[model samples]
Target chain A: MTYHVHGVSASGNCYKVRLALEQLNLPHVWHEVDMMNGATRTDEFRKLNPNGKVPVLVIDEKTTLAESDAILCYLAEGTPLLPDDRLERAQALQWMFFEQYSHEPNVAVARFILQFLKQPGDPRLPDRIAGSYRALDVMEQHLATRTYFVGERYTVADIALYAYTHVAHEANVDLSRYPAIRAWIERVRSQPRHVEMPGVDQ
Target chain B: MTYHVHGVSASGNCYKVRLALEQLNLPHVWHEVDMMNGATRTDEFRKLNPNGKVPVLVIDEKTTLAESDAILCYLAEGTPLLPDDRLERAQALQWMFFEQYSHEPNVAVARFILQFLKQPGDPRLPDRIAGSYRALDVMEQHLATRTYFVGERYTVADIALYAYTHVAHEANVDLSRYPAIRAWIERVRSQPRHVEMPGVDQ
Candidate 1:
């Protein structure tokens, strides 16, 4: 059965699902949500995701899943995209949680403020940017010794973090200091069947 | 091998690890970190986690895992606490992600501000409390028809959310409005080997 994805194209979180689907060559249909026009906030969208967030994976008429990383785990379960070793799998989850808690709220939110909201002077920007750099510092240190986030192979953990890190410049978070991250970003881009994320309309 | 966990007992994120370890009957040692005293900021702690966060699960001298939810997944793997079915497993992860992203930041942070920092009037509290209710609303809606977060049974998803949710009062976020949530909290508590979270020294 084909999967139906409800998402905002320019969003890094949504892009993560698309990237995985393309890489896996999974049959799917994408329906873009007009997030800028209050589409996600509507009653109809709430049925797809009570959280009212983008990137909802509709497995069937009766089953739907929200949260991009969880969707990633769902799609990548039996593939090489997910590791088979128990400890390696947990390590992958470790980075994904780190991304959601530490990285995304800072980097992705900063990007939203600058790119979507167009509020460079937003008082929250300072802390968001500072937190973005701090998250980057941790990623850099971890990536310094490894090719991938876990077990030296491409996995959903990489997809989760790569979603935002690749577009961090939109967040106005500089990446010149993180050579390892730069190398890893290029490596992710070079993966088989890799697809580029659609840029946000400025 | 026994798991060595470095965490702060009073923190809900840390408490999640403790609760899972206890309920699963897993052999583990807990090392309480003095987060208020800048213990997590020290060089030694950084060696355990470069992110400088508590709830580090050290599997061996060479391996360590951070992020409480990831640790929970690790400890719960192959057990009833983690679902064996793929979709149910993904659903478990969905709620776990929601807890870290939507629930903990609001409920746990507000509790930290009030109980630990003693900042009842902190400006961030209002927004945090509001977000806490939003997260609770989602949980209450989900739990209104189900016995647990996933598969009608206790899982790490419940543990992940129950951490801050049970003590939301400390965050100054009232739970009286959420009957479903209140009922689910008791259900979770009734599970075998359940342990009470140690209250903060307020």
Candidate 2:
């Protein structure tokens, strides 16, 4: 069955679901919401996702799901994007949780503030900017000897991180020091059917 | 197999795993890591979990998993605590993600700031306090007629949220404003084999 995804174009979280759909070759409809315009706050949007966040996946008329990584897991089930091994799956989810907690809050926030809010000099940026580097360091170290985040294959774990991390430069994150992460990014981009984030003008 | 859980007893994220283990009747060993004293920063601890976060589940000599919700999912899989339905499962994870992102960042951070850091008046308090209310409002509205976060049964979703939310009062969160949430919290507490957060003096 075709899925219906509602999300803003530029959001890394939203782009995560989009990337999965592309990779999975799942036929779906996209309804773009301008999150910057407070679209998610509208009552109509809230009815779809009470969390009031973009990236809601309506799998059918009866089932709609939110949370980007959750959507990724749902879409990737029974596919190569999700590892079949139980431990590998948990490890993938571990990194996904890291993306949401340690990585996104800093990297994505900085990107949102600078790229969208256009407030490079905002007072709240310093910590976020610093955190972006710390998260990158963790990823660089983790990727030092591994080709992918989990089980040596491209998985949703990689996609979950790739979403915001690929755009982290907009948050003023310097990717130069992370040789391994840099190589991983190249590897991910080299994957067939890779989709670029919104506004990349691909 | 008995699991080895490395965690800080007072951590809501850590406790989420413990509560699930209790509910699922899993045999496990608890090794408390004193996070306030920089215990997680120890190189020894770092070896087990590079993220330097508590709640690492050592499922075997070669298999250890981190991330609280991820650990809960791993432990709860195939058990009644995890919904068997696909849509219901996604709904469970959606709320778990919300707990990690929206609810935990605010409510747990507030509790950590006050209970652990003993700084109730920290400048970060205002925004975190405000966010706690906003998250509570969403939960309250959603729980207006529901018994659980998803599928009308107690699941990992409730466990993930209950860890920090039940103690939101310690964060100065005015739970009285959300009667639905208050009742839901009580309902969760009534679950058989539920465990209390550390430092509850139980």
After superposing candidate 2 on the true structure, give the runs of residues whose Cα lies further than 4 Å from its correct spot. Answer: A200-202, B200-202
| TM-scores vs. true structure, each candidate | 0.99, 0.97
The number of residue pairs in model 2 that clash at the backbone is 0
Off by over 4 Å in 1: none
Task: Give every collision pair in model 1.
Answer: none
Model 2 C-alpha lDDT per residue in residues B63-162, reported as the tens digit of each score: 7899998898888778888887877877888888888899999998988888888997899999999999889988999899899999898899999888
- Number of the top candidate by TM-score? 1
lDDT by residue (tens digit), candidate 1, A80-191 = 9998899999999999999999999999999999999998899999999999999999999999999999999999999999999999999999999999999999999999
Name the 10 consecutive residues with the lowest summed lDDT in model 1 chain A: A193-202
Q: What fraction of the real A-B contacts shows up in model 2?
A: 0.60
Each model's TM-score for chain A is 0.99, 0.97
